[model samples]
Target: MLPHDDNPLFATFARAQIRVERGEGVWLHTSDGRRFLDFTGGIAVNSLGHAHPHLVAAITAQASKLWHVSNLFEIPGQERLAERLTEASFADKAFFTNSGAEALECAIKTARRYHYVNGQPERYRILTFEGAFHGRTLATIAAGGQKKYLEGFGPKVEGFDQVAFGDHEALAAAVTDETAAILVEPIQGEGGIRAVPEVCLKGLRDLCDEKGILLIYDEVQTGIGRTGTFFAYEHSGAEPDILASAKGIGGGFPMGVCLATAEAAKGMTPGTHGTTFGGNPLAMAVGNAVLDVVLGEGFLAEVRRTALLFKQSLASLADRYPEMIEAVRGEGLLIGIKPRVPNGAFIEALRGHEMLAAPAGDNVIRFLPPLNVTPEEVREAMRRIEAAAAELSGRPAEGAAEGAAA
Candidate 1:
């Protein structure tokens, strides 16, 4: 230990004991050489699983040539990735960032810019929803409207107001003349896996239309085929004017994207917004590789079919453990288990069963296995969950639920 053992600069997360060494597919190896099934999938970042051949090749190829370059030059990888992103989704333009928070920041900027460019500078307020998880940035934390994360962050940023997550009436009331947009997650990943109803997204879209406000979906955890579709809104058939994407975008690499229509992006002039490492060749190459795998022939369809198996399996588990595991929610592989016991207990119980799961807000455990997880793997995961449920039922000694890994 250093002479000053308690360096205040370090974060509280240093309490974690395990040090992961390597991972492949759905298995992670810790420094102690214990193998664990990675149902968390790095909290849904490793969509293709750890060290996938495609991602490895992309990173290696890019590393051998170029790793970092300023955004001044015309990077081929960025252009290609931008084209792919715009083509795959309902976006006319794309802005790259290095993380989810940055993407949300860019989305907020784009939304306000949309109104500003259209001669409505007063339309700067962004209306977000309660239980929403945007990101860790100051603006994003304020925009998220989750009180737990806002602690000690004195004086929240302005231009953000929030209402009930699914209350359309409160949402409508929140949108005033100065409201720039309504931002939400199609599925609230960190908010206990609560999914906004399709009707809710549709209503928000209609509201945006009537009020001439922009709509933004924080798809950081639900995008990149994490849901049944490439984007969750595809299932609802609702589109957003501005969208923030990250997490699984680069499979496991640090990559994010803020997408918008050309009209909404007009205010993003040359000097308006910028990120040095956003569109670096390395990130773009990895993002392209991820896109290639997710958009491959029938890959997404397999995700849907596998999701069906997972949902059915979790539902059956819930049936068996009526006193322990209750309801199952979320879309595609982004599944959650609302346990009768504390969700953290289930997470710890699964550790002994050689499986790992992430806990979300509220008393829920997220089964965010990789998108490429096979049916057999899903069954195995369910078996582990059932076993964990049985074990957790016996553990009356431990109290308090799981903390969110999301």
Candidate 2:
């Protein structure tokens, strides 16, 4: 075996030490026989949690028939998935990809192309929020406008402008005649679960309409019922001309989609864009299976109910341990807690309690549980969180003193 410090893989992520053996529902079983309640949800990718029977059966069935066939041929599954997605959203067309970054890239291209077709090729610049995170690709990193992700990536890509997050004056001032679109995330997941106000979303749509520029929403993390709605934008009442979605869409499968209005996609004619392994039969099968569950009767309502309970529980926990938790933020199952203690320390403490969570910017710990997470699971997570808080505050857990006396 490789020495602990002599790994062949690139040292990019500060990965945890736990080795997972398998996962089922909201629980993960580690190689060392430890069971962990999973709230990270594979960074919001596992919509239905690990080993969902429907997803597994769909992929398995598709794998037996066809695994891959390039975009050259007309894939029935891809067409059906696209049709369903467009029918459900504000888009008339859909383009498939393999990751959220690709979806954002495609959305960017579609926005620029819309202006290009109108005989204004110079109007290619796009405006983004200061703390936004589009993706890891060079173009997307530039679009995100985060210096940390752009620091070592050589010269930043051109034609992207950024404005202070939620600063309406700055956002309006940044828009120029050359701007093709304004890109935003309805709920900023990586930026610490910060949600844009519904009023601000409507104002952005008005500005885009008045300026004759398209509005693009990067719903990579907030789409596919991660939020109470099918898309977070559904709560804002402002529809984007283009939308980029991934993450939970495939329920852990590697897939993405860029949806666009018919008018916004006018320039994407033949030879405009394409992909190789995107929208393969395997991915389409999984994506469809995910939709079958997410769009099922009363599924989204259940998600809303569970999210409310979870958030209320977290709020109460924060109230009880003000020294450990500063604030509870976010919508639906995509929640975050700003802690008085260091986020890393809190995350470590939670891990010690056999509950997995993810760290975010702004010194927050995110809890992205499955949409179908049960009330019992929420209570169990709350117990673990309270234990973590007690340990962090240097106090014994609820029953620790009684157990010791016994």
Q: What digit string (tens of lDDT, one per residue) describes model 1 on residues 1-406?
A: 2334675656644333557899999988998888888999988999999999989988998899998879988899988988988998999899999999999999999988878888899999999888888988899999987787899999899999989867878878888999999898999998899998898889889999999999899999999999989999998998998899999998888889999988888899999999889989999999999999999999999999999988987787677677887799989999998998787777887888778888888798998999999997776676667667766676421111232111
User: Across residues 297-358, which tens digit of lDDT does each residue of candidate 2 receive?
Assistant: 99999999999999998898888788888999998999989999889999898898899999
Query: How many Å off is the CA of 269 in candidate 1?
Result: 1.1
RMSD of every prediction: 4.3, 2.1
TM-score (all chains, Cα) for each model: 0.94, 0.97
Record all residue pairs in model 2 with backbone atoms less than 3 Å apart, i.e. clashing: none
Cα miss at 203, model 1 (Å)?
0.8
Candidate 2 weakest ten by summed lDDT = 397-406
Cα lDDT for residue 114, model 1? 77
lDDT of 2 at 219: 97
User: Model 1 misses residue 191 by how many Å?
Assistant: 0.2
